[model samples]
Target: MDELRAQLIATARAMGSAGLNKGTAGNLSVRAAAGFLITPTGMDYASLECADIPWMSLEGEARGRRRPSSEWRFHRDIYAARPEVGAVLHAHSPFAVSLACLRREIPPFHYMIARFGGTTVRCGAYALFGTQALSDAALAALEGRSACLLANHGMLVAGRDLKQALDLGIELESLCEQYWRACQLGEPVLLSAAEMAEVLEHFRHYGQQSGQQSGGKTS
Candidate 1:
């Protein structure tokens, strides 16, 4: 349990190091034997100790010295809805936010967009943060994709594990930034659905399709 807590903390700190988050603006969680260990709300990840991480049940029951993030509802909803998810990452990355503010969806401007499990990355409908409505909206956007932009909010991602979630979050911000830049010049050329369908098929075998983590993430 201690090791898992430490790993969760390490992953949170890594987000800071990579600039995926700052201060306490973002939250991360890893599935636990009982429920899950999530970064406490409004607490600086930089100063967190193992005990500072709180455990919360899928039923929304929280246990620990600190309070779970206000967004805990969605975390709980996600775990209950997606059996394969081991971790969830939420970030307010600048580029993603810029596009999100406009409720823009990341289209198949690049074939690499298939890394998210589709030809286009969806932008969820606007909902106030920390509400069940927000979770509902996020879940809808993430239906067939591992990552989605929260309209006028930020980004929500889930993975099979902590490392996968963190790495994907970084990659997502990069893609959003690239797409944002492309839009500055002119409308970016989008790939065909058939083309991206093929990429999705190839991604299934990317690296280790047999026993390796295919897609290696959860929505």
Candidate 2:
């Protein structure tokens, strides 16, 4: 458990180093025995210690030296709703936030769109941060998907573990940037549903056949 806590802290700091987040504008968590361990709200990731991370129950009780991230509601909800998810990451990344501000659902303009387990990444309905409404909206947008944009806010990604979750977050933000840049040129050409379906099928078996983690391949 202590080791997991330390890894969570390292991952949180890595988010900033990877440019997926800055300041305390993101939160990360990994499933735990009692519940889940989450990064504390509004703290510098650089200074975090294992004990500073909070263990939050599915019912919302938090334990540890620090308070849980304000977005812990969605983390708890995702764990409760998605049995396969072992980690959740939310970030106010630049490109993702830019698209979220437009409330745009990313279309299948690229084959990587299927990497998220769907043809499009839905923009969740807008709600105040830290509210149950936000969690509900996110869950709806994330149906059958590993990631989604929070309308007017940022993005959320879930994975089988911390590494995968962080990788997805990075990939999602990169896609958002590509989409944004392409849109600046013109309405980007979008792939048809059948095209994305084919891509999704390919992704299902794209990675190595071993238990080794593949950064860009999920599920």
Candidate 3:
């Protein structure tokens, strides 16, 4: 899995460089048959390497050189709860954290928010790190959606793969920034539930079409 490890390190660094995280304030994980590879605790993304990554079992036992990120519990719980999730990303992006601290949900202010497949992006209640309570809350908040903001902390996003997870993280942070800016102008204009449902349906069909095109090209 050296290639996967290398990709993880590179993607983590890219996320940080893109301002999706600061210092060592983010963690990333990708599913593996035995368990998963995750970022190490207290390691800066800019200098991360494949050797610095840690492996943890689905049961949360450490299996590699370094201790996994303190949010290992969060990642483990997510993987356990959602078998379809092949990658997880947690980041303390500025706008998302700001909204989380304010205890506000990311409303459906734009069609891009439809990627979440819900009326609004939920926020899990604050719980201490590495605790089962936080993991449980996060799972609940993420229901019917690919991502959720962690109250007073950051965000948790899951995807079918690492690239998709990274994309979701970026989209979430961008939506948060837009919401914040719109609020500054006046009362933010939010899409109604029916409108959001229509948007979500469109997204679902679009995804199907794209998948078909990709399959056709590969074949």
lDDT of 3 by residue, 1-219 (tens): 889999899889878877898898889999986688999999888787778888899888887788899888878888888777888999999999999999888887887887865778999999998788998999999887899999999988988889988988998999999999999999977788898778876676554553464211100
**Model 3 worst lDDT window (10 residues):** 210-219
Mind giving the per-residue lDDT tens digits that candidate 2 earns over 1-219? Answer: 999999999899889988999888889999999599999999989989888998999999999889999999999999999988999999999999999999999999999988898999999999999999999999999999999999999999999899989999999999999999999999999999888878988887676677866544443
Which one is best on lDDT? 2
The list of candidate 1 runs beyond 4 A from truth reads 209-219
Where in model 2 is the C-alpha error above 4 Å? 210-219
- Candidate 1 residue pairs in backbone clash: none
What are the models' TM-scores? Answer: 0.95, 0.95, 0.93
* Poorest lDDT segment (10 consecutive residues) of candidate 1: 210-219
TM-score, model 3 to reference: 0.93
Q: Give all candidates' CA lDDT scores.
A: 0.89, 0.92, 0.85
Arrange candidates by lDDT, highest first: which order? Answer: 2, 1, 3
